[model samples]
Target: MLYKKKYSSWLHRINPALKLVLLMGGIIAVLFIHNVNVMIPLVAALAGMLLIGSGQPIGRVLLFMLPFLFVFVSTGSSMILFGKGETLWWQWGPAVISRESFYRGVHIGLRALSFGLIGLLFALTTRPVLLFYSLMQQFRLPPRYAYGFMASLRLLPLILEEFKTLQKAYKVRGVDSVKGWKGWWQKLRLYAIPLLAQSIRRAQRIAVAMEARRFNKSIQRTYYYRPGFSSEDGLMVICWVGIFAGAWIVGVQWPLFEITDVRFNE
Candidate 1:
């Protein structure tokens, strides 16, 4: 809900397409890292960047990430609860706990969190319309596909507002709210039909508008927003690379965990 069309952040100055590429490269780099010490500090550094680079309230970012707890927990718990190891700490029919598994579990959890933060960083700083625009201008993406995606993005808010309006209309007509799953299904059907019709009509109008505007893949067109590369992009690269290098150096010199490679077997 903390949607902003403009921010004075240094990160916002970087091109959206470049930001996506850097984030993808960072994720690939993270996958090769098996050291928990490196990942731990790297995660901390990313959180710090969210505070410094994003120029948004860190509290808002933290609030957005609250639900990710379930994701990382589920990700790490699987390895901890069932992985095989030499030193057995606990055993049941199928579930096993061991020293190696504990290390692996911690590693998996941190890795998942690392991936989540990468995605969060991109979503927090980048605007969807700008991203798609960059795709069209910089990446040479077809105009039809790019503009279609932009139109769909615009539709989301309209759908939500229409849904609220429908709810109020029903309430005024003395329609009671439902409690259980059956009642929920009925309510869903009630809204779904009208919403589907409205969406179809809106889509038809959008298609007509696009045709009038000549959004052809082969046709050359001008864009209102032109996201170009700049010095801020270079600075962002420097900052990210520095954080990753520093964390790796710290881990190698002073590792808190003895097991460096979670995959190695004795």
Candidate 2:
């Protein structure tokens, strides 16, 4: 929301096809890079893009990434407590935990966090309409599907707003009134019913609108917004290739994360 005018962001100015390619390449790199050190540069590249390309403030990027960071740490630590391997580092009677598992956990958690940030970067920099257009052009997606995708995109923010209002209303009405399991059940019911009803109503309206526009009447349509491929698009493809190449070289060749064998046996 704090992003600069759409066109002003560096990411916005770059070709959408390139951004999408870069994000995909980043995802693969994160998957293979077992060490955070190896990931740090890649993450930095994405962060820099978010800051300079998106014209988004640094604070916004940090705030967006905070929740994923918390999840990564919590989940990684929890995995270490339950996992077993050759490099056993700790034990609590029945459970045997290993150092190898600890590092593995770290890898998994950091990768998840990196993925979350990359997704946020993509969403922040890309306009829904532009993305739809690119998908249609590059992938040859059907117009009906593209329009349906756009329709859903249009309502996503509104649905989120509605949910927030419901959450606030529950707080005001004292969701704790019922207490314990019953109270929790009441909260779920209160939130679920209205949300489901609203979703159904919204879907029906969208279906009606599509029919009115004769969206399904033909497989072809005129494009008001056409995207042209250029040298910039080529550059984006190169960027994607570089990401995969860099991560592969670092992960397989140098081995930043070392695993010490610790087989547990009395």
Candidate 3:
């Protein structure tokens, strides 16, 4: 399920504009936070919120996060091996490990996890239509762009279904035996050509329909659904501010670990 509706979740109840603000704010804060201790807890909190708002089982959420974990590990390992630092821990011909580099690597990995969890939370709980409506209503976004975006999202499932049908048809016609790298390339070309043509035809038809309805004729329009700020949005903002403040305070005062960025200048 790409975008499941969770009517009962608190995240769902909050306005989309507020959620968008939280998402962007969290990401920006995470970027400047270099301490692993602070990042780890932030990541955990975001993950917990995501799980709660997703209304999905813990097992499923963990399963969904496996790929992100893999990426985190890969990036961390690379940073640890290549990053430079003053306190040397291990050395080889070309690869060196240092205490600072190791900690930096861990921080990078935790940062990735924190960022990914924040994004996942937004993507899982928010609906495209709601976001569109909220943008147009609260932010005064142009209706033409908002409706076009909404239309594209609506067409996504159709495109996926068309691809699946094409795959099945090919299999039935005994042309699905392709394997290996070369065969994968061949299969991609085969699928890509038809999908491109289908998408173009669909886009043309949608454009005609929209134009017929005078979608772009006016900048002012009435919306059936209007989104507004609520108490929940206020609470969400407060909670996010507290989380960010607490993380920074603890990181600065307690000093579980220090974040050092080495820079050289002429």
Best by lDDT: 1
Each prediction's whole-model lDDT (CA) = 0.85, 0.69, 0.78
Ranking by TM-score: 3, 1, 2
Candidate 3 to native Cα RMSD, angstroms: 2.7
The TM-score obtained by model 3 is: 0.87
For model 2, the local distance difference test gives: 0.69
Q: Write the per-residue lDDT of candidate 1 for residues 27-99, one digit (tens) a residue.
A: 9999999988899999888878876777777787788778777788988898998886888898888989888
Candidate 2 per-residue lDDT, tens place, 84-136, comes to 66767878886667776676677667677768777887888777687777777
Clashing pairs in 2: 9-53, 10-53, 11-53, 86-262, 86-263, 87-262
Give each model a TM-score. 0.87, 0.75, 0.87
What is the Cα-based lDDT of residue 123 in candidate 1? 80
The alpha-carbon lDDT assigned to residue 225 of candidate 2 equals: 74
